[model samples]
Target: MRYSRSFIHTQYEVPKEAETPSHVLLLRGSYIYPAAAGIYSLLPLGHRVAEKIKKIIREEMDGIDGLEVTMPVLNPAELWKATKRYFDIGPELFRFRDRRQREFVLAMTHEEIVTDIAKKFLRSYRDLPVMLYQIQTKVRDEARPRAGLLRVREFQMKDGYSFHPDFEDLDRYYPRIYNAYLRIFARCGLNAVPIEADTGIMGGTGSHEFMLESAHGEDQFVVCTQCDYRANTEKAVGLKPAVKDLSANPPAMASVATPGVKTIGDLMEFFQTTEDHFLKTVAYDADGRLVLAVVRGDFNISVTKLANHLKAVHVDLASEDLLERHGLFGGFLSPVGLKDKNLRVVVDTSVGHETLYIAGGNAVDVHLKNVLPGRDFPVTEQVDIAEVRSGDTCAQCASGRLDVRRGIELGHTFKLGTKYTAPDTMDVTFLGADGANHRVVMGCYGIGVERLMASAVEQWHDEAGIIWPVTIAPYQVILSTLGKSPEVDDAADALYEALRTRWEVLYDDRDESPGVKLKDADLLGIPLRVVVSQRGLKKGTFEVKVRRTGEVFFFGRDEIEAAVARIVADLSPSLDGLPLLPEMG
Candidate 1:
């Protein structure tokens, strides 16, 4: 389709609010427009690109026999209440009231709605293994939606939820989506890494996140570029460098008086040793008053697991006032009957098994030395609070060292088991061969549509403009008609018509200079460009340019259609079945 002549001179400059590469080019190229924080109005150009990506997603999802269903965007809050997620999801959910004053929300996700539908209609084992899906808009109130379309509050998404009878069934479909995700990213011109995910807020034991590696990314990933291993550090499990029993040989923990020193740095400077040489103790408010938490000071708190230990909704460092109120020292807190309340205590997996170590006095500026763990401060239980970092041991690659990188979460899939099914959920059940009722298991897969577009630009663009993949480009070929003669326009318009039967063509039928047309073509970034100029027309030739590769070829008008058709045909066939899948058997 021909873009508005206005688009050529519209001065598609990047918006001032865009903070990331994708956000800049997307706004500059007229792909998307900001509507509100975390929300956007996808312009024609952006909408077309998003639809193409969604089509690819539909193809892959359908290929997996993913049954398509359109759930309501405004879900009743009761559905979430049934699944116990009404309050569990926290404030990200956009809750509101309808005309009748009934509570509702622009659906943050469809798990609860999908499962509720299943519970009523899906009874018996015959419906045991159903994979249902939908491509719709999910509304989430992101407190800070700064990265343009990358973190929008409301955007298109392809969310799928499946029901199964067993974990093996869930495991089998895991790779189906896994392999499909790889193809989706590859076709979108991205090298996304599949990482071990924590399944946060999603609340599942086994989960994975497809991430595009980039410094501008919001998620953290640990990758072994040497091999094929990668994971999100939030959920990454790897070998930790042994903090070798380097505890002052003879393992003697003695409090040395250096006078008025309190930090590990203070202790290190006085002892003239490295962080690796000392035992690190940190105090945290898990759920109640105060219990000392310890890690090798060198390691970080893997709060993901720590939260699970306290069985609490969330955890954070104690406030200064709370510290003083509890009679605990800020940096010197340790385990010594300071169990103020249900004072939940947690330690790193490394420190969880340590027999004895120095601790805090829980008061003024005193610290315990050579205090054995069980003998010093007794805790009700233990947990892993340290996050694994780079240069640490890699659990998967064994001998290989570990490292980390940041990325955005594009797609996530998890095995949900009975999380959605219960005795009250009579809508979900299967029949055994003996006719007994059996509970069906469940799984889910999701991809953010707008985020995928943003991720591509984040990874593919250069300073010129967006470098869109051929499969998703708004126009597969841009026909730039240059020179003052109308003959050039007629010739290119005819060629554009011929190509339109099988491809998308952007014909620049405007009275503009060759330089202007070319610059605009670069800015629009159609995968291919053809110049119908008077100079070339006189020579019985037209200039054909590959926008991505910038290779120009002078080809005769007579053979131009065939050449362009061949290039497009070669790129069209297989790219169609990917991104989205075909119906499953």
Candidate 2:
């Protein structure tokens, strides 16, 4: 490809909306163009990189006995309705009416469509385990699409689903996909850490996410310092240190009049005590039902954990009207007098049993002292719903402390145990060896193609521009002809022809200055740059510069191809001796 004829445009100024490094460089380098607020069009350069990523993903998926198949992006609404996801997923799922007024939905995922296929085929025990995968487009009406491809409404994804005879078989086959995911990310020049994650909307028993730690990432996770325990904040758990009782001998609950003292901070200041001596209550509207969540003052509630506990589709803060209708106060709310109320009550495990603490008095400018759980108020439900923070004790090892970090999620794997294959759902079944029909267990794995591409840029770029890895770079080598001498031009043309036949070489045959050509080469992020200049040619040699290391080597006129081959070999990511999983303590 020649720069003069190619659709390549480099910008000098960054766009105002480009916040992350990948977003800024991709736009300035002309790799992607914003089509809408959350949609983008991949230019020629970006398309080439995407193709390379797809090729790598295909190879890895095929190695695991996965059969490639293309599912339609437009799916009938009846399939989703059968699976009950049509009503469970809210505005994020794109739904519309067709010409005949029939309902349809854009494919946010293919779980329902694939299960429908499995129901039609795979009749016996012999077809117990089968894997199907596809590299296709997915659509989600994201409310806040920011940071370029990292969070987009429409993007490319490689989603795979496997059906098995039983839970035992699915559990055994899960590690193969896990190891394959590690290799795929390593080959793409990313160090993604695997962490336990919540199965949001997927409705799975367990799941894990592959993440790359970065400050620009939107997801937060915690890592143990002494053990192998790691999890996303939405599902993370920590060992809470035991707290002593506020009072040695328990006293009866008593309410005191306090003027203008409503918040926990105000109560703490008025009593001159620590926050741990108080109880905090929060009200939420979980799927139109009022839920009062109680936790210790030192801890905060995790909304994801709360929603999962109630099995609700949508959870938001409860309105004042909703709370007042149930005779609950805004600033002073408690579960003391709500034992027979129509709403649900959830108490965090952090609120110790038989321990006296301060609590809401259920009246204006009033609070209760000597409040105890199971003695003064009914303990309806007790669960772990507090947010895990940095420096907390590790739940797995108990000796290690946790470090909270932010990262970008590159891939996810889920163990779905008959969630979509049950009789009430898709009804996908297979004949077992015992002459009985049984529901097929399932597992799903997905990798965001564009998100992976953008993550590579985020992980590898420097101050100059993007530093793409050799495996996924648009072109491996860039040949620039500096100066207007006929000899230099002829030499560069011959070298370009020799290299194009064997490798992906971009020839900068445009009439541009040396400074502009070199700057553009850096911005494009080709791994190797081969220069044929008048000064170097007169000295009976040419120059080769490595993009990653910034190392320069001078070679004879006839040594361009050999030097390039050797340098590219050294710059490539090696798969030799790669571990399937990280070392555990």
Candidates' C-alpha lDDT:
0.74, 0.91
The clash numbers for all candidates, in the given order, read 23, 0
Candidate 2's C-alpha runs over 4 A off are: 576-585
Where is model 1 more than 4 Å wrong at Cα? 5-13, 225-227, 245-263, 279-292, 336-342, 352-359, 423-427, 569-585
Candidate 2, poorest ten consecutive residues by summed lDDT: 576-585
List, residue by residue over 164-221, the lDDT tens digit for candidate 1: 8777777777778777777777777676777778767666558888898888998888
What are the per-residue Cα lDDT tens digits for candidate 2 across 1-585?
998999999998999999999999999999999999879999999999999999999999999899999999999999999989999898999999999999999999999999999999979999879999999999999999999999999999999999999998888888889888988998898888999999999988999999999999999999999998989999999987767764577789998898988667789998787898788899999999999999988999999999999999899999999988888888888888774466788999899885678888888788898888888888979999899989999999999999999999999999988999999998888999999989899999999999999999999998889888999999999999989988998888888889998889999999999999999999989999999999998898889999999999999967877888898888888766654653222
